[model samples]
Target: MAKSDKKPGTRRDILNRLKSNGCSDATTLAEVLGVTPMAIRQHLYDLQSEGLVEARAEPRPVGRPAKLWYLTEAADRYFPDAHAELAVSLIDTIRSSLGENALQALVLERSRHQTVLYRNAMEDAPDLRRKLEALAEIRSREGYMAGVEETAEGLVFVENHCPICAAAKACTGLCAMELQVFADALGPGYDVSRTDHILAGARRCAYHVTERETVDG
Candidate 1:
């Protein structure tokens, strides 16, 4: 089949396909997605920018020319079949770098860092409006859609969704860890909640977070 016959594949689709196939050319990907090879190139560029896909030159004896595209080891994380060993390796690295207790502490410390960084960056804002805007800017830069609002109680930092987590639900534990980090950074007094109504569903995210003044035990 020609590359132009397939539909345009999203980043997730591209990653999943690559994970399963190991390597493929743009034409092959386009053929699978029912889109033009050019469209596949565009998606590949997007994925490449995110440190997912990679391309390599292939010397062919016939035809005009073609380059072989492949998924990096990083891209393999999207496939469930590959994630178990990857997770083990990641945990092993963590265990090697930090002792068990220290690893746990590191997780907490990093979460605290995320919150503190967000709060400190927005410290100069005069009002809640500006604060929320600042927070949104920060999260967007980090690939999230963040919003803040003032309810009847106090200010709330709502992370609309997590893009990375949405790609692989098995990593939702990491999302919970991040929430814990945010809570720790925001302090023990603020309430943090994760909503089910995510915008992107299993693809992206649509989350609602409400911050409270006093958190109960």
Candidate 2:
């Protein structure tokens, strides 16, 4: 892959600035990033091509209308919060009013729904890798920022961003429950183990998925 000319964190910084300012021109973005207008334009060009940023023409009192850059709805994922606070609060309320058993039951119910969706997606998949890839795509749409990678020994499925991080942190058992659901969704032929956990201070949640061979006794 070709490397980006923008400095490290520059893309994120640009996205953050546009997120806070709403709409701004190259001149304003340049000032915010302490770079020249030319540099800002280049970055904006790249971002626009990626469908993360958009340029709109707005009328000015003085001269011609200036084109201002704004972050697209798709770019919202790059920002913080991700609705984790609300999810965590709801989980807390359920635990407080309904008790731990109630909370477990609710999580189970949700997990069951997820299992059905995952099973449906993976049913026609031919191999373990395709099943994992399909799972990642489904999770990504649900705001997990998930992806899959191939390895010599087994496949590694990773979720870089957790939309319900706060809720998961509030209830650690959700992690184990997730592992179980994943195993169940893919059937009993594979051993799926969590290699990294975001709730445990890791930057992501990863599972090492390895297929098991059947032997006749």
Candidate 3:
């Protein structure tokens, strides 16, 4: 056989694959990474020993259960956090000295600013698909690892990673305002609903965006 030019996957690549695609068995991960299942299993075991990954038995009909590997909370250290500690500290400071109401005002202002920025970025996007693509690019640049998925019903905007997860946990207002920002950024005639939330124990955040019929007044 001829030599292959593709680079072999690293532990970080395995972590990233799990982060983006959720849980998977060693066999599946091996196939995706162009390596043998035994090699992948060894890597997974090493990661498990380091407390970065864990495996759960998934039931299989008429056969032994398969071990599904997934990233543990500790694995989050490998991903980008976008200055999580500083963001959380600022949130706490604002709420303590500026008051809860003032903190809320700041959140709203931040959402408004995001909405305007996103809108401006998507201004020339011609249609909903293009607009969603533009929005995903903007968010991915901001460390959300965002992408748009097309479905028969509509589009699913997926954020494979949340850089502000720490700040969002400290102040729930950030998540709420985020949903609002997405709605406003997409403009009218479209409804954006959060289908998954990382804070709620999901591996990633997903938004279902569908068009709503508008009747002329």
Candidate 4:
């Protein structure tokens, strides 16, 4: 939901704000965009009518209930999940024909292939931070809009977008495979586990990565 690929004052801009800031009112949105609250209200109304966003009332004790805007489940389609039409269709057909066990096996095979590709990109990353950075770069290249957060405990790998979300949802095994791939790529020096998943309704995919006993989060 970033504005990098979109111009200011567009629907994308509004959505990006709500995405990063959680639910917000028109005044807050106008202040952020330097626009009139009326203009922001129009945008919010349009988005709400389109079912992309939903507005809620928040009581402030004295004034009218403030209108807070947030994205609807339908808005998830606007995120990074691209290149998925054919992929999901093909996966659906495979699963329908081959059965669940075969699909799981297929996911494992695909994970191994992905692991190799990630390993190549991360092979030279010596430190824990470097490895996290390298993995983020690789994911960004694949349209995940990935980034790293350095905390006192460990490096948090956050992917704000998932380009293959449709495929992953069609087969949750894809998510499991991704966790395994991350662990393998980083080797035994670190433990990698997902704390947030977009499929589980989280805004992003977040991982708690611990390096040895020093970095735990």
Candidate closest to the true structure, highest TM-score: 3
Error of 4 at 147 (Å): 1.9
Please rank every candidate by lDDT, starting with the best.
3, 4, 2, 1
Off by over 4 Å in 2: 1-10, 13-82
State how far residue 98 of model 4 sits from its true place (Å).
3.3
For all predictions, the C-alpha RMSD in Å is 13.2, 12.5, 2.2, 5.1
Looking at candidate 4, the ten consecutive residues that score lowest on lDDT are: 1-10
Q: Give TM-scores for every candidate, taking all chains together and pairing residue i with residue i.
A: 0.42, 0.65, 0.92, 0.76
Would you give me the overall lDDT of model 3? 0.89
Runs with alpha carbons beyond 4 Å of true place in candidate 1: 1-89, 96-100, 147-173, 187-190, 197-217
Runs with alpha carbons beyond 4 Å of true place in candidate 3: 2-9
Q: After the best TM-score superposition of candidate 3, give how far the Cα of residue 103 lies from its true spot, in angstroms.
A: 1.2
Clashing pairs in 2: none
Error of 2 at 91 (Å): 1.5
In angstroms, give how far residue 189 of model 4 lies from its true place: 0.8
Q: lDDT of each prediction vs. the true structure? A: 0.60, 0.81, 0.89, 0.83
Local error of candidate 4 at residue 82 (angstroms): 3.3
Clashes of each: 10, 0, 0, 0
- Whichever of 1 and 3 has more lDDT, that candidate is 3
